[model samples]
Structures are given as C-alpha cells and as structure tokens.
Target: MPNTVASKRVHVAVGVIYNPHGQILIARRHDDAHQGGLWEFPGGKVESGETVCNALARELHEELGIVVHTSSCTQLLEIRHDYTDKVVLLDVWKVLEFDGEARGKEGQPLRWIKPKTLTKYAFPAANTAIIDAILKPRDSSFSSH
Candidate 1:
C-alpha cells in the first residue's frame, strides 16, 4: 500500500499570560531553540501524552517558574504559520491567574510589556496577530487580567 497517512503537523500552545498591571509576559526563545532570540509568549509544544491545557501549565512552570491552574486559562486565539522546516499551529491562551513569580528559569530573558507598547519591540512576524488581539478592546465578559 502506498503511504497514505499524512504527517502530523507540529502544534504549539502559547499563553499571553498577563498580570493586573496591564503588563503581558513575553519571553525570548533560548539560543538553541527554533526562532531563538525572538520574543514570544511563554509556552511550549504539547507533549505526546498531555492535553493542550496540561501542556500550557507545564510550559509555564518550566519556562517561567510559575505554577498555573489549567482551569484559570482560556483559549484566546489560534494561529498557523509556515516556516522553512515545519508548519506551526499556535494555540494562544490568556492566563488570568497563577502562583509564583515569573522568572526566566530557562535562561531566556522575560519581559512584562504593556500591550499598546508591544509594537515597538521586535517579535516574530506571526506575533503581529497576537499583538492585534491584545490591543482590541475587551467585551463585557472580559476579565481585567
């Protein structure tokens, strides 16, 4: 039989986790990882045995040294982008609450930036949509965080 199964696309979950101060947490990719040195949200790829929410929680812990309850995060947006080696599908989340300080435990620099001011920083092209989403006004159901 000819090979008929399609290759599984690489998907990543990113969290636009922010605090009440209107500062969004962004992290620089480690020098060895893909798109290293570029500023992006704090998250990682979903592992084989974990759900997206679980992955997000784990990533936040690993990257930021913060423990976030999965229930506290909500899906904010999803994006797909094609790169030279692989296609990436990014599921972005908005984390309303978590525990512990967000340190760059992975040796990447972390910054808390105001959404309106994000455009001034250099980010991956795909991040433009994420920024736009952040800048849009929230609705009645929106939480301040």
Candidate 2:
C-alpha cells in the first residue's frame, strides 16, 4: 500500500532587511520552536486574508519593532520546502527602506552582518535559496525602488 499522509502547508513572509551600511539583518529562532536556534531572516507566518506584503509589514513590526514601508518593499523571490512534518512556502522580500530601529521585539537575538558573512551563520534548509538570492548580484529584474 502507498502512503497517504499529507503535510500541513504554511505560508511565511520573510524580510531581508538592509541598513545604509550594506549589512543585512538576521534573527535567531527560539530554541523550543520548530527549526529552533537557527539564524534566519526576520519574518513570520502569513495569516489568512492577508497579502504577502501585508504579512511582511505586520510580521516585521511584531518581530523587530520596525514599520515596513510596503510600497518600497520588493519581492525578491519565493521558496517552497517540505520537511518531515510540514511544508513551508516562503515569500521573501527585500526591505531596503523602513522606519524606526530594528530590534528583537520578541526577545530573539538579532545580528547585522555583511552579505558575504551570511555563510558563517546557520539557517534552516528552506533559507538556502534565500541566501543564494541575497548573495547573487542584483539584476535588472530586481529593482531598488
């Protein structure tokens, strides 16, 4: 007989925030949560009836205490990964402009490091593509505005 189990699907909105100094922001997940203790770009799960941009803004604010200017935010890429228990779809965005300081409002540790140094930190498997997209040279398709 064939297996008939299906994993729950979770939609997440992720932000790759950058400062004027060219450093990117990252956060550590709570040690008790799924994929815990890994460094990740700050973000959270998208809620029902919410657009990815809206989710990004809300999650960023709730997680980092910063207001995301959705108009200036750019969709960098999307990634879907399946784990043993669940499937995650990551809607990644490039957050170049925002208001207020970025801090861990939820008590997670935060780090601002150069893009080249991203490899030094540990991230979930789903974030591998996000890291690649961040490290790759920005092409015309990716706009700063």
lDDT per model vs. reference: 0.84, 0.88
**Tens digit of per-residue lDDT, candidate 2, span 26-74:** 9999999878999999888999999999999999998888998888788
Off by over 4 Å in 1: 1-8, 137-145
Instruction: Compose the digit string of candidate 1's lDDT tens values, residues 9-108.
Output: 7789899998879699988887787667788988889988888889999989988889997888888788988766567899988888889999998788
When superposed on Cα atoms, how far off is each prediction in RMSD? 3.2, 2.4
Per-prediction TM-score to the true structure, in the order listed: 0.85, 0.89
Report the Cα lDDT for residue 107, model 1: 84
Q: What is candidate 2's CA lDDT for residue 107?
A: 90
Model 2 / residue 83 / CA error / Å: 1.7
TM-score of 2: 0.89
Give the distance in Å from residue 124's predicted Cα in candidate 2 to where it truly belongs. Answer: 1.1
Residue clash pairs of candidate 2: none
